[model samples]
Target: MATQPLIRSDHLFDTVELSKWELEQIMERAAFWEKNWRPGQAPFAGRFAANLFFEPSTRTRFSFEIAEKKLGLHVLNVNMEESSTTKGESLCDTVKTLSALGVEVVTVRHREPEAIQELLTEDTGCKIINAGAGKMAHPTQALLDLYTMKKHFGSLSGLKVAMIGDIKHSRVVRSNCWALGKFGVQVIFSGPESMRDHELEKIASYLPFEEAIREADVVMMLRVQLERHHEQLFVSAGEYFKNYGLSIERFQTMKPDAIIMHPGPVNRNVEISDELVEHPRSKIFAQKTNGVFIRMAVLERALGGVQR
Candidate 1:
């Protein structure tokens, strides 16, 4: 009888390191799994995986758990509040312990910008999937965003994307910039000047708020990170909505084919008006739906025998 081939360990850190071909494979696989995946279709049956989310989350955390369960892995959800970390045990120590105990994949969301990097270097038996690491990266989120856009437009090439709202201090922006740049997408940045980060200025052109919206094929409104939105002048929620948010007037001028997108927990009437959240053209919910399938592809890629 033929023996199964040995698989190499891999990590999905930031989409910056991903090539176009690799991205295509993931996108293709995600679509395939979305159409074909059935209940209890467990490919990684009996293998173990752990979610070590040091920071709070909702969609990303739950999506990972759902994907892990669907993949047939024994899932361990570590509550940092109750975990040994409260007893002074280090994160690396906990991860190493899990690896020793046969955990084969660890999905982590941490606040330290460099914490995930440290784990990438450690020679553990399990794969490291960076759920989100501070403002550094959120690869999985970008993947699903890409999957959503592609599913809608059929291709990302030559599409124009307006990434509005808080740009600085957004890990999602960093990952999206890296992933979307590969597909010939014209990513323009616009929002309150205070929210703009200069480091990413070179890759994306800064357009005036209105011009960016009117000309784009996809209008992706980012959530205003209230904690990080440190503007020189205090811009109140109502003022921001009128001046910068996607109001009804602005939405009226948008191209008929143009679609609205947001990585949500939306500020309702702040970043986008309440009426537009579920608007005919909004892909916000579609992005959330695509998130699950995209994660299914990512989790399977990590634990389902892909080479490093």
Candidate 2:
């Protein structure tokens, strides 16, 4: 029988699906790619990849496009609004069409978590990557976040990460909890009771805002998704900041080496203070920088790069 790929799936849906060994391989490969980047190395010379994003994105979409091109793959980026999907074409039909067009890989971002998985059948020939899928999972973000932390700390075993804000709705948090657990990393959820998830509480401990910040090795703040806004989910932004935001005073209480993180498109002073976003200890930008290499590693492995 042929050996299975390191990811063991044609689609990457969530972090829980990846073993610790697989995570390690991805990080090791990312490190190698980061250090040994050459002017022209095309790992997927003859292959084709497509990015199909139904949601608006600045980082994830652009970074994936860069990774695909860096690997020397022909990339097709479809404008969801301009595409036939807007004319009532189903997602399944659209993806199958890409496969029919000779595209070998497709990275997609949609609101429903199960929507993309519906395309994963014996008949579909293209590989799928979950960029962001509703309130369930953003596996690649979790992968890049883990790679960033591992690259910084050199180990994940004793790390404590406090995930603050919008826990119930943040897919990044959902995937992070799964990835962190595999390495014995302590995961703490901190936010207003409304944003806290009861189901996730079973996997990780819930801590008060101050307590969470004080104990963390990494403080990860989440954006308040105004796009997913429902009535009464938040009050005034000023009031929310006073209670839950990472003000400069709260930042001062943190260990000097402890880093701050946020998955992009920040709400500025809402979840994190404006001043601290670029503080020396902030890994927000580093996370963005690491995202490219980590995604390159993912693209290569998903296309069947030899396991290290």
Best by lDDT: 2
In the predicted model 2, the residue pairs found to clash are none
lDDT of model 1, residue 160 = 94
Residue-level lDDT tens digits of model 2 in 1-308: 12333444356778898899888877877787788778698867888999999888999999999988888889999999999998999888888899999997889899987787786653567888888998889988999999889888989999999999999889999999999999999999999888889999999999999999999999999988767757677788998999999999999898778999998778889999999999889989999989988888788777777333
- Model 2 clash tally, residue pairs: 0
Per-candidate TM equals: 0.94, 0.95
lDDT of 2: 0.86
Clash numbers, per candidate:
0, 0
RMSD of each: 3.4, 3.0
Q: Could you tell me the lDDT of residue 246 within candidate 2?
A: 97
- Candidate 1 has what TM-score? 0.94
Q: What is the lDDT of residue 103 in candidate 2?
A: 90
